[model samples]
Target: MFAPFRPIIKDPALRLAAVLLVLFGAHAATMAPYVSALAIRVFGLSDSAYSAVLLVASVLSVSASVGLGILADQRANRRAIALGTSAMLIAGSGLVLAGDNAVVFVIANALILPLSASIFGQLFALSRLAASTHPERDRPAILSTLRALFALPWLMVLPIWAVVFDHGAPLTAIYPVTLTLGILIVALTLAFWPRDGATRWPDPKSGLTFRQSLREMANLPILSRVVALGTINGAVMLYLVVMGLVFAATPGRGASDTALYAGLLAGLEVPFMLALPVLVGRVSRTSLIWVGAALYALHLGLLPLLAPTPFVWLLTIPGAAGGAVVLTQPMAYLQDLLSNRPGAGASLMALQKLAGDAFSAAVFAIGTALAGYELAAAAGALLGVIGAGALWAMDRRAARS
Candidate 1:
């Protein structure tokens, strides 16, 4: 297990990037739940508040990510990360400040929460930067390892947040702690990974203008597919996430069993993602994607079989399989596609993020409005099948050519 950990970089900036990722990942897990806990326990909002929280989070994230992506194109990656981390600090603090005023909290969420994307989106920019600077073979491994770091949050912060919120802790109580943590992490990021000129990529001479980047990415075949896949997957994922309440409420399931089901799905993402580098390196992108699409279809197919009993635990295998496919290979495909055109790569990434946000929101809104939980599941099941068919069609087209 430890043998895979070899020294790839002795430089301070790269090391700092890794550390910043850990902190950001932790912040990501805690941020939503913190505000949510407050809304439920302190503000006395209804369960609809949870969906509202996700919608608000999605909006702020998409907006912030786009702005910061453009800023990243124009400014330093470290600077964006710093500003973003600073925003997370402020956002977390605002949750505490908003207290019981649900309306004020929602506004704060819209404005302040999106700034956290500065940190989240910066990681992608930084990875591209690192690949540009360092050796190529190491890039996938480096990215995969960083992604595995994301699982740490569920382990460290999520369980803790669940405990606090489970007992009905105030938003005031939770937000302050998360805010302090954000600030400390930001400080560490600055101290260890100081921003400098070289990190500021855009200049008059790079020839990578925003419009040119977007046009170039628009024409890239693989990036287009990746973005499309993300759009579909994101919508389905959001539908599932929102519909989880229904799954939990499915007749005989206890709250503990539901929590266990969710945890299994989260925990399964790491090892599969960790193995993606090796898998993508060995398999053709088309082949890997087709396999993934098939697995995703199977996973969603199995979901309906899950009941309130211990048998539901078996559903995690398909769930984890689907996550592995989404988290691992499409990224490597996008990175490979972007190698000759990093600017276009950045734009494609932004597009991917935006599409995911928009499509997920649309699905969630429509799914909820149509009916309650079971109907939503039926819709999600259709999406899974349809998405898989789309991928299969794309694969067949590629094969013919």
Candidate 2:
């Protein structure tokens, strides 16, 4: 496990990148799990209203991601961008915490959160650029290690959230804490970010125009295949959007129980993700993805049957394993497909976020309206199975080509 990261730590720049990812990951973990609950409890949003908010956020997030990716590709100062975005994130969190009505919360979610979320694309672009300087075989491992490190804060933060919720603290507690972390992230990034020239992939004498890059990406079969699979993966994520309400409605559970379950599920993913680099060299990436998809199907399929009991939540362990694969493999695969274009990871991620979030919103609205969270989980399971088959077919085609 430590073997893959050894080479990464030997270089000062890679080491700093890894640290920055941890901080960023912590910030992300704090808010993502509770956003749905916050919307319902604090802002009195219904399922459809929350979905609409997400739809708006998704559109804005896509735009920010594309704009940031182009800027990064053009060799703009990523550190400055990241710092400014972090500040925006803090301000967004403040709005969520203090807002007494849905309108303010919607603005924060739709505008500031999407703007802040673009930081992940920027971070991915930066990390891939740094890794480009290293040995080819080591790149996936290095990035996987960074991803695993990201799980660390989730491991710590979620359980603490569980405890806080149990002790009568409001969910709004997460906002202030996340805001503080966001400020720390800004400071750390500004202080330790590699010099602009030091971390960049050598820029081509002439860069592709935004239109050309979009055309190039659209024409790539590998990217299309990955995006198709990623959309199916997004179905699985619908479970999370409504998970808090699902758990609360269960016979013996409430907000604290929901938090604990989320925390445990998140904790389970850390080891799975940490083990991914080791598995990559031994297991084929496509095969790994197929296995993950199958596990996700099994996990989601069981949700309706088992949700009455707390043990049902354990299904997330398999869900986490599946997520560990879906999360790391596609990014690595995308990076491979666009090796010459340093910003392609960002661009592809932006597209994936747009596609995935849109699909998730649809699932949430339709499934909840048709039945409830149980129906949504079942639909997600069916989609995961479809994704697994699609991946198998795509892999075979790639082998033939």
Clashes of each: 0, 0
> Could you tell me the lDDT of residue 332 within candidate 2?
74
lDDT per residue for candidate 2 within 1-401, as digits (tens), equals 77768877887667876776787777777777778887987779988999999889988988877766766666556777777776777788788768746888789888887888777766776777778778888888788877777766777777787888889998778788878877787777788876665544564422677787667778768566656666655754675676777766778777776667667766788789888877887988778888887787677667666878766877888978987887777777766677776566576777776777887888778888999887877776677667657777887897899
Sliding window of 10 residues with minimal summed lDDT for model 2: 197-206
lDDT of 2: 0.75
| lDDT for 125 (candidate 2) | 69
Which candidate's TM-score is highest?
2
Error of 1 at 399 (Å): 6.3
Candidate 1, residue 92: CA error in Å? 4.5
- Indicate the residue-level lDDT of 66 in model 2: 71
Off by over 4 Å in 1: 1-4, 8-11, 31-60, 75-82, 162-174, 199-205, 220-223, 235-240, 247-260, 293-307, 340-347, 388-392, 395-401
TM-score of each: 0.80, 0.93
Q: Which stretches of candidate 2 lie over 4 Å from their true place?
A: 200-206, 220-223
Per-residue lDDT tens digits of candidate 1, residues 347-369?
45545655665555555556657
lDDT for 250 in candidate 1 is 70
